[model samples]
Target: MSAATPCVLVIDDEAQIRKFLDIGLRAEGYEVLLAADGAQGLALAATRSPDLVILDIGLPDREGHDVLSELRQWSHVPVVMLSVRDAESEKVKALDAGANDYVTKPFGIQELMARLRALLRSRPGEPDAPQRYDDGHLMIDLARREVALDGTSLALTRKEYAVIAMLLRHAGRVVTQQQLLRDIWGATHTQDSHYLRIVIGKLRQKLGDDPATPRWLKTEPGVGYRFLTDH
Candidate 1:
């Protein structure tokens, strides 16, 4: 009910599984929703916008892959697939189709909860945190809007500071172009992706980074950019 409660949707036709997940997730402080088929799952996904989805490969209406295909059209919600088939090809297929992680059936509840926590920790909707970052070479204090490289302070323009601060806040994860544009440049500027490109270029140059083989910032091609954390 409360907006802060992390929500999990379990899409499985098996009644026992649904009941099991409902109790376990609730006990773990998650708001749980259940669906018996792909259609219901997709509907809940669209309407509820749950924080995570646990999808079963086999459904009465259709395959979960088809459900994932539809979900990927508009949503990038983290999905952990559940399947009885532990075959390599199935896991590959599900991941390729947009499943974030795969857990074979007969899994331990503790392991599943751990995976859920890991996914949530890395999830994009997470609020910005950990104000200070230092990897010896590059250091940033987001709250103070300060950055230093190799012990010397690096001068950065306002836009450069804003973008880099956001990137550093989400290190090791791709921050989508639209998200950057809207957050940094306002919602109306979402269509002006060129502005983001120009700003990012300047930031890279100041950081002494090469776009082709970036040490700190990596381009996600047409989608977005990710800050490389493993220096």
Candidate 2:
């Protein structure tokens, strides 16, 4: 499939529902990924970075609301929740937990497709990250995946680059340690703050940033790290 084609991940337990969505989404020209349960769905979501997600409210392994909570910790991908229950409370819970839309089971394919189209259209044409960033001292070309200090290229390890790139993507804002760990090292490493600390230290050292008087990277003390903008 072309890179521009939107990918949709459907996490549902029922074979019929999964089949129905898989066929319907593909027919509508959307690339489709299917998961039989919450664990598998979460795994795919972490690895694949699909454009959108259709999550079932009930799963064999866990409640979909719980899955949505875990997903919100790092990703803001649009999610349209599916459920057989049409209770007002259920819709409220899903929205409160971060789902973008809710569709009760037995939904018409046309209606579901319409909702999906609207959500996809509502997304920004570009991702949150800037294509490139350059200040007098530091430069980052996210499109080219390059970083330089004072016009000299810097050699960074994969983990190091991942950390710095994530920071630059959200420049001038705090990026929680758990977010860095989960996004770069995987969800299993979210509790391992020391890993993040080591990477942060190395990043600061390479960038010639002082932790005490940070020019680029700032420590949020017991919270997370933030990449300071030149302004």
Candidate 3:
């Protein structure tokens, strides 16, 4: 891999899966870090701060979801989940737990690579002063960390502001619950989807979005959530 190659951490208990990912990612010019379980994965994450993490749902020592929760308490590094479970509910659980994206078992390498590229491209750019986006009466000033509705300013708490900022940064894309929790509350709170729900509710209220019929913040049912800019 080149010196400027992005680093990826693979946390899977299955040796075969890890090896497969290691080879595939290396071919794409990424430096890969391997961990056999969640504990080792967390330690490597803290020490190496890899650009992204590819995590398995089932680990030998700890549940992948738990690892994700712990990572969210402190890191904003992107995480893509790998799982054998194909049920939508399971996928939602992973996303709700803060995973950036997920790949089901038996996934094609091409699709996985594409998702990785899309996610990396979707990551927030370097921090800058909050800037404003306006579509008629809806306005958001990121630098000031403020939002306004039809010329009226809306009050928002720290967590609320963080969630909105995240949505704005990734506008038009889904912001996984895990990513939000990690970004807002840290990795340790990623698994607490209730926190995410509460903050989103407050955001919707401030934005004048009806929870019953939301126009801005849209829920993806079992998946995470998305901020609809087309509204």
Error of 1 at 84 (Å): 0.3
What would the per-residue lDDT of candidate 1 be over residues 1-231, giving only the tens digit for each residue? 244799999999999999999999999999998999998988777555688999999999999999999778656789999999999999999999999999999999999999999998887765556699889989999888889999989888888898998888877766777778888998788768899999999888888999988989898766678888786
How much is the lDDT of residue 123 in candidate 3?
76
How does model 1 fare in lDDT?
Answer: 0.88
| Ranking of all predicted structures according to TM-score, beginning with the best and ending with the worst | 2, 3, 1
Which residue pairs does candidate 2 place in steric collision? none
Window of ten residues with lowest summed lDDT in model 1: 121-130
TM-score for each predicted model, relative to the true structure: 0.55, 0.64, 0.55
Q: List ranges where model 3 is wrong by over 4 Å.
A: 1-3, 126-231
Please report how far candidate 3 places residue 162 from its true position, in Å.
26
Q: Tell me the lDDT of model 1 at 132.
A: 90
**Model 1: per-residue Cα lDDT at residue 2:** 41
Query: Candidate 1: TM-score?
Result: 0.55
Return model 1's CA RMSD, one decimal.
Answer: 8.9
Question: Model 2, residue 116: displacement in angstroms?
Answer: 0.5
Where is the poorest 10-residue window by lDDT in model 2?
123-132
